[model samples]
Target chain A: MNVHEPERRLVTLSDVARAAGVGESTVSRVLRNQGSFSKRTQDRVAEAVARLGYVPNRLAGMLAGSGSTAGAKLVGIIIPSLTNIVFPDLLRGANAALDHDGFQSVIGVSDYDPEREEALIGALLSWRPAGLIVTGLEHTAGAVARLRASGIRIVEMIDTDGDGLDIVVGFSNRGVGCDSARHLLARGYRRIGYVGHDITRDLRAAKRLAGFRETLREAGHPLAETEIAPGPSSAAAGRAALGRLLARRPDLHAVYFSNDDMALGGYFHCLAEGVAVPGRLALFGFNALDIAAAMPQPLTTIRTPRLEIGAVAVERLAADGPAETVDLGYELIAGATA
Target chain B: MNVHEPERRLVTLSDVARAAGVGESTVSRVLRNQGSFSKRTQDRVAEAVARLGYVPNRLAGMLAGSGSTAGAKLVGIIIPSLTNIVFPDLLRGANAALDHDGFQSVIGVSDYDPEREEALIGALLSWRPAGLIVTGLEHTAGAVARLRASGIRIVEMIDTDGDGLDIVVGFSNRGVGCDSARHLLARGYRRIGYVGHDITRDLRAAKRLAGFRETLREAGHPLAETEIAPGPSSAAAGRAALGRLLARRPDLHAVYFSNDDMALGGYFHCLAEGVAVPGRLALFGFNALDIAAAMPQPLTTIRTPRLEIGAVAVERLAADGPAETVDLGYELIAGATA
Candidate 1:
């Protein structure tokens, strides 16, 4: 029961070799599952490893400096928040791709804090990961300097609005906003309102809002009302925001939410409040999340290439190509809500 | 632009020391921000590091055998799936806890595959993480052996149905099922049915189902019907499964779903099909997710302490105590649905 001793002696590769009655190199080969080793010798080494409890220090192997294992088979990934389904979706894609290529991910959640992101970047960098994938282009000057000087393959994902430190794989957030506004406009819904979570922390949302307002202004129909929830996006916040927005601007014909989570809340609000979606009040959202489609009346939203961005970021990192931006693009889902 | 040179020379601590006109020890001390070092020396080392792109290898530092950095400030966390918000919420809790303790997490997704879990365990083990956190108590023999032999702390989370390898932190899934069934029975709903996703992969769900069935049989009601979707739990799958369950046995007075995601789907189905919930058919679910509370008719479900389980697991790992099971009990939310 007392498993947590202060300092238990670690089992070494030499211990495995000694137990197996084989050379240290043979034990190493069997443990790495690399180099030439006979089946009998492999079985012996495995038995010794299990018996001796030899957990190989892969860091030592990397320090030994074989060409293939020169860099640790690890990728450092920093995302804004895990609460939003979007980041998880991105991580799922990146993890799958990295796993396929025999790499593991060390993850840090920044919680939309620039200073935290910088600290996470430095912590992750100390591990000497093969590559680093960060969420956005916006970073503190300290973070940017550290990333630029790290000399590892760096990938900035989920937004393609500005210059990137290295490889950038994502669609334009502003474009998604502009397209969403156009879709709502095409549906002949004017006097549009906006309901969203905190945009200050979510720079992408801020960009989208800018583009949306710009498009609406050009059309001579500016946003009628805006309700910005104080914290991270949630269905409850979305519902309450929609309620508050509706109470303030009852004449608004349509509502554009920051993302699908907020929009789902808006839809639920409509359902609970006896407001006919699209008939009484049109609703539009971003990120065509699965739940968005599963709703009784599907939510009209912009489907960003979240998974593709993560996957392609890893792919580009592994490919080790030139520093360039790859715009995977986005799609507009014209569901019943709009 | 051509960052992908085949053999880019790596900057070393020695190079930083040479550039800064300081000893390698001073550079190391400055990089770690540990030990006694002058502010001027720290500035010099930082300037040199920035100039030479020197990424201090923390692994190498650990190998050098400093007690403070003896074991890497890393914890390996392996979860089943990322698509399910439950896992993210758990990860968020664990990550927050780990981050607070100055540890980063290396994550792997087993995708509910035992073989994959074994592989991921082996992979994570090579990193020599300070501790390991895996989703369930049920693991392959290989994984169990490796975990037992690893000698470091291991925390198995989110289910307490069976014995764990080390520290176990979670509520009993079977107990959740029993309580849910009892709640429905108390609400005067007989002719009950069950709808779930592939329980063959999700062992916890299988345990819950077994408990639900046993409790129902004890009450002399028994399960009226059952419908299981072929893949992972999803809103779409849940909605379709509920629809199919209803079509097969319209006389069923109540239904229990795998979790809140499925329950939400069923709720949406009721909304779409105009099935009067708790009037004609009562719906019960597990895992009182935030969305479950946000629903118009709040879902009747068990609120498992997911965040608490994760945080407690990390706390137990850090505490380095005796191997023990910590049962953070679940709460039965008596909502409007059941």
Candidate 2:
């Protein structure tokens, strides 16, 4: 990447006006996308600007807008993983609300690293966004301090197990896990096992596992086996993890997965090995992704309020209402898989 | 969502400095992430700023920097969809490269709508980003014009069939389709079918289909059946489309999918129906996503350089390289399924 070269004469509005044969105000009106201009004029101005490589100084124009110091109408959203459909779905919902409000989201991906999250927080805070939305409550100490130090409205989304920095919206991960365990146990599945990806990175999954195990222990029917892949969860990893688990404990009646991605992997494994689903090895997962229901035998899982959490989070952020934690709950789906 | 209220009193640096019991220069140094300052002093300033709700005017600080007119170190990345792993993969790769360069990506999702792309272009350009990266060359005319007029470095990624508005980094979609057709034909499967989502929305898929047909015509073999889902492509849609195709023309020895997503759907359909993959029905797809390899019978598909396109596009943009198109071609994976 090349660094900025030595100073050169900057292109001004007058340069664009001279090039387009229009006044400075006409160039400003056309470039800002505010005032109306003739199609021919817009085209001519656009062509001239392109040819001259003229950049409009938005900072100057923004400050010049109607005698107000409103910082950019921007919001910052930081997510853990883009690979997971959950985050994308949340983003989709958030964008719907944000777009309607005429606010643009500036996004950052943490890739589930706390240090990266902190760095992104510092960078985003530097922009002084109107509001910031982040995935989970868990953050590095620096991130927490920086967020608290930044006066922008903050929304901690997707998890509610911990105290939020500001407005919190989402279901409890532990509750979803506890409900999943009870649902499976009520269906007469003892000798349960677990198949998932790394727990250290995915704190929400860890909470789920904790709740699942707690429920099992209370029922005097503890987990029989567990296969934890030391990486991010994928269908293949889930399938491989289940293979390892079943190879060791073939008598395992059922298995819980980190999420639908892992469960789908297990489901594929069952199909490949000719292990009759539910009758042979019942499968359960969280985040009832679309593929889960469309499976040959629909997957029995927990449907977390992913889209709603995002939409409502944006709504609250835009509202600038009194800060509060909102627990949008999850639902259990009884499908043919379990 | 509440509308912005009338203009109010603005918080100044002097206010922050006074509240922190420090000089304005000390506060500015800590806020700018520049000059040496003790942790205690930084904390004191950050606390005061948050308490006083002071927004540092980035525009003024930016202008205060050495006489370079570089806008905020931000790049705008606009994608087609977040639902498809393709875009997420692209984003992940782009973020990795951009983060390494100390640049941040502000993303917008178009969801394959040209109008949305145009609107997002206008909105993103309003930020006066240092550069902009968009998914494909086929954009609304206004979008193309605005992007050209914005005078920021532009990188058009993932497709290279059309004249780019700026630096283009991707292979030909038509070439990929033609190659996919040839791969299946060489494997001795002639009675081929096609399944996809809406062709009108995704111009790239339409280009692929056009190339596939051109190749098939050149081979003296045309598609036996075609199933194009009205909505976005998904595994379920793939299954339904294949089911429809088989119900009409059971003689289809092989099927070409729009991408791996639809192919995975077909793969799942074959699994559920007890049809032996590659024996009873052959499957081929584009974009060799990770799940395709994890399948019991790995899917035969074209591995597009999605990650490379994203990473290299950012590299080229950061380098401010001369305007030219870069073709980071595709690879054909001869997996077990085909």
Q: Write the per-residue lDDT of candidate 1 for residues B245-305, one digit (tens) a residue.
A: 9999999899999998898889889989999988988999888877778777888999988
| Clashes found in each candidate (C-alpha, N, C closer than 3 A) | 0, 0
B152-189 in candidate 2: lDDT tens per residue? 78999989898987799999999999999998889899
- Give the chain B TM-score for each candidate: 0.93, 0.86
lDDT of 2: 0.85
Over the stretch A1-338, how does candidate 1's per-residue lDDT look in tens digits? Answer: 43535666678888889899999999988876888999999999999887776778877876665235444687889999999889999999998799888787888899999999998898898877888999889999999988877768899998999999899999999998898899889889999999989988999999999999899989999988899999999888999999999999988899999998899899989888999899999999999988778888988999888888889999998886889999999999999999
Worst 10 residues of 1 chain A by lDDT: A62-71
Number of the top-ranking candidate, with DockQ as the measure = 1
Task: Show the colliding residue pairs in model 1.
Answer: none
TM-score of candidate 1 to 2 decimals: 0.94
TM-score of each: 0.94, 0.87
